[model samples]
Target: MPAPKNPLLPAVRWALAVLAGAVMVLSFAPFGWFPAALASVTAFYLLLPRGRRGGFATGWFYGLGLLGFGVFWIRISLNEFGNMPAVAANALMLLLVAALALFYALAGWLVTRLRPGEDAPRWWVGPLLVLPGVWVLLEWVRSWLFTGFPWLFAGNGQINPLPLLGAPLAGWAPVVGVHGLSLAVALSAGLVVVALRRGGGARPAALAGLLAIWLVGALLARVEWTRPADGPLSAAVLQGNVEQSLKWAPDGVLPTLEIYLDLTREVLADSDVIVWPETAIPSFLHEVEAGLLPPLTADAVAAGAEIVIGVPIMEMAERYFNGLISVGSAADRYYKRHLVPFGEFLPFDRQLRPLIDWFDVPMSSFSRGEAERPLLQVGPYRVGVSICYEDVFPEEVRQALPEAAYLINVSNDAWFGDSLAPHQHLEFARLRALENGRPLVRATNTGISAIIDHRGRVTASLPLFERGVLTGTIQPRTGRTPFAAVGSLPALLLAAAMLVAALLLGRSRNTAA
Candidate 1:
């Protein structure tokens, strides 16, 4: 019945899968070789075996390679900042990586299990249709499942300038969002694989289709999705460059506040809007309102500017929120809705308290803000605000569009240290700017503070671990892109439809045989 399995074949496939996964990391920030993303996915697809178990094994190894190397910086936060033992932190990181790899293993298993019999007419169906759909669907699930770790996505790599190719396809972001671009990349990779296997007959069509997809993307990139609604305003983003080790220390509090306040004063004369990084104040708003607010508000009013700064807010007994407040303007307050698990607040606190206490993380008990909160009004413009990691979720950014003229995201990335995390985080922010057809101003505590235009291009930025102010003019856009209008619904629906079509096609072929 079954042919004898070759012992070396399994070893070769596993090795290829590992290599594919490791190489995929190069496609991300600090080393942005985007073409590698396609190649890595292609290599992984080629190694996947027909059997479901073998497919699972290959996928697991591949994911191990990708996330293991991609997110290695997590250890820095856990060991250096969380005060976890080096050995324990390394082990914990490994455990988390292995668990995340399960999602990829499931995707691989589904691809192999859903394939039609060998005699099926459409040999290209599995790679072209099913695999890409399964891959993107799982990525979407990974974004919100168990609080989500949406990092190092396929589309994030494309945010870097690609000469002709990047500038053109950049328009595709607003139509389908990052998940849709990932699907297109997978489809292109599939076409390349199919062309190699099926010989001359499929090669020309495959090549032509691949070129056409990119060409269309390039043409679409030329289209202006949104327009400026008002005159450009001078905005300044302040990077405090606070050290994570001393940030919450009793003696370090006032100095940290002074660092941001000094930087704000430097730019206030010319800036219409000034922004400070997350938790720049290092104290509750009420505690500082009497002393800090009066002077800051007076300065802003005298300078004829609006100031937005991040500070913690206490609402009820022991219930606090990570929030942003506007001064010398409409006095709007926006609280962060999405909270980071373990980092911002521990889930299942009673059960997990012991483990969390051992790690020694600071401010690990923030309550989430309401999702339907109003936008922050800065001077004449209505701004959408995302705190720290919230910009990574496309849906969160989309929720602020059409009404909010621009966006401001504040983060304290000092926790990540000297790693690729900051670069990757900036890339994610750029995509959000592209997706919503709105300008984005990102302020961080210790690096990658940037001014991104409506097209997702970084116009200016400050170096990492630098105490400085980035001043630039940002145009306020009024219209919404397709993504801002409909959100991820269209992309998710298309992925579902593709998977269903593949299943129906496979069943029909099996019945015929």
Candidate 2:
């Protein structure tokens, strides 16, 4: 139902729209929206009023502001690589933002309909179960719908120093999965707004509840979910920082190979395992192994270390794959299951052939590896590894968890330059570490290479875009966290159940009224 149009209401509506935008911006504040729980609550409150469909307008505006700020770097890709005229690029970019904003619109609409009253009986239940349930449900839906852009789910905001104990108990951090802790944070934020307006002593109770959540996380952090299965393992991660310009040029092959081998040989004395960023080999694996096989294997064996290098594998009949190969003793091979649509392999490559070449896709036609593959074992550790774009997806990494002692991701973000892509990517890896309760070792082509502990803290790192190696002794843990054992099923099921209950409760209340 539309309220009769009031002349001054448009101004008020505009102000609310701007406030919604501010809330979205605050969602990415330094400490994160989770801690303050401000943005989530504001979003809920703004959309809760009856007879006012402000949710759509408010959500769309906020999304425009949030995406415009968070993913502003898309222009770099569109203008620099897509080669679109400015007007066309901005319009397309806005279209993406608008589409993403629809999820928020859905969130707002769900909350409003679930408001407790004569029409809806489960208003209270909405916060208890429906809020977290629907929110996570939407996130999960978004992750797969339209090929997914599961970037920075509300959960990612709860990373580190935030008492992420729920991460291990829930089998993954709420931030890492669709439901988990991040939904819990949103529920709490809504509760906070509800309490504040009621003008009661509930504020203390809310604050205490918030404290308890963090306390639980702190307690869980103390527990070492895993331990060294046998002994210490040493590994070297190579950061080539090769210029994006020459990395794929035919002339870049020899220099790229030489630089990696040179660095590998230098660090061979110190590390038990050596790693290179995704596609560090430049040329296809089968093509380069002829030249790299003999000496590199001998050197690894001599150093008692395994060499894990990222390369492109072109199979018979021109099927290509982004993969990692382990050389020396205990060596095994693993291919990336999740591939980047536009970057690694174009979705519709044949139709987009000219567009692909324009984007400078080095080897853009890679095939996907099996959904399930064995972990790559290096010495005492069974490594669950993901290549390049795989890290962005938390669920995809779980397929490797049971057999793997840790998570290793190798990427080449030279494509994204020094933009927020690298930092944002690194953050995703950290959340994955926390979610799975596994130490994550990430090696990138041009900087932001890091070693993240099970608690999602960076223990060691090498500068981005610099030619060097990160050498560290990492202990492999044995036990599995709740996440490692079950994945997102628990969260998804919970969300589904909440939605069902909300509907039933709403129906029951309407009948009673």
Candidate 3:
């Protein structure tokens, strides 16, 4: 591997790193340029310095570019909805982006520290095995650490159902989940960087290895892990398009209830089950039980349909939860287990309360539900329910599988407005469906409400910010995919093994030298 004749200056390299990170956003929703993820990561890999400090700096800049642009919607939620002042919100957004960028910096430092030197015989091992493993392991750590921000994974770009020249890339989802795909993407990028630098026999090997990974992924996409357990169930997903400003207002409560009730009544006759978005009701379940439940339950029973509605629930006055309840035929409830940090429950509230009181986020304080709660039964089928961002966690979704006939995710994406968050969220839902090999019925407020089949294909959908109902049929699947059966253990094990192999190979080469 020869050094460049005219190496880029430090300033130019940093700029390129930032540019590479920003370009990664195109690989996700709204743009859907899937190949850009590989290209962007490749650029980042090529920009990484041989020295540890320089590598960290390069990665930090890349992360700033990636997260700063990708999740800019956080500013929307803070400023527009949370009513945070522009300066404060922007500062907070920058702080969060910088905090998240540390993971990328750590990944870069780890790769540089562990990788073989430029002249080592096993230099190929670093890019092909070590870098991808370190990258994904750090990504996994970031997902759960501090109530993870698990967005913008490299595999997320492949969630689109569209195949590449007749090859379905999303097929790998059922076998390895998103982390494996992220690993593959990182490996490809690293290999590209290696091939570019080492123009020898290593070049062809790296290229061939890259092609093999994609080809295998395409072939894996065709494997069906779960099969239909029952006939398709007609479902009606209501999109009330409720405005965030008016949602909790004193006068708007009744109208909001009326909108959902009317939509349910309209679709009750034709649909087997009707799903409402997250927090569809503005008030507590007990408060509305006397006034709302009787009529709604009666109406559902009369139509021979089940109704699932989202509402806040008060448990013994002091404890409250953001909950979903199924009325009519099936009587069950699920409280959200994974609460969003700051958005749902503020962390370190005692310390931050003075500052936090400035933002006017409603129902921001809620208790997490018990993790071992039973699945909700709707008629003969057992339904796995995820509220809002819970769908993004593959392991969280897997807990209900094997027993769950299908999955239902209820969300209020109106918080994101017309940003890429909703579209990216929908993509997450599709990946969950593919991973679990279960059909997913998603009901969202203000857009991208959809019914996705086990294959991760959107069968039907409702447009964003529209007040309407989407009627679609979903086949209940009973079997589990390899992903569902083993969860992320296999992927984690593979990553660990690769890192071990890289370390051993690097050590052996150093000992010989």
Give the candidate number with the greatest lDDT.
Answer: 3
Give TM per candidate: 0.96, 0.88, 0.97
Model 1, runs deviating above 4 Å: 1-8, 117-119, 163-168
Alpha-carbon runs more than 4 Å astray in model 3: 1-6, 161-168
Alpha-carbon RMSD to native, per candidate = 2.2, 3.9, 1.5
Of candidates 3 and 1, the better by lDDT: 3
What's the number of clashes in each of the models? 1, 10, 3
| 2 or 3, greater by TM-score | 3
- Sort every candidate by lDDT, greatest first: 3, 1, 2
**Per-residue lDDT over 119-206 for candidate 2, one digit per residue giving the tens place of the 0 to 100 score:** 2323356555666776778878888885778875666656634353333222237223535665666666656654554334545766
- The pairs that clash in candidate 2 are 155-175, 165-217, 171-482, 171-483, 174-180, 174-181, 320-367, 446-465, 447-464, 447-465
lDDT of 1 by residue, 86-189 (tens): 99889999999999988888878888887653335776787788878888899999999998888877767866765544644455788889988888777777
Worst 10 residues of 1 by lDDT: 1-10
Better of 1 and 2 by TM-score: 1
Per-residue lDDT of candidate 3, residues 370-455 (tens digit):
95933677766788889998999988998998899999999988887889899999989988998999989999878889999988
The local distance difference test score of each candidate is 0.85, 0.69, 0.85
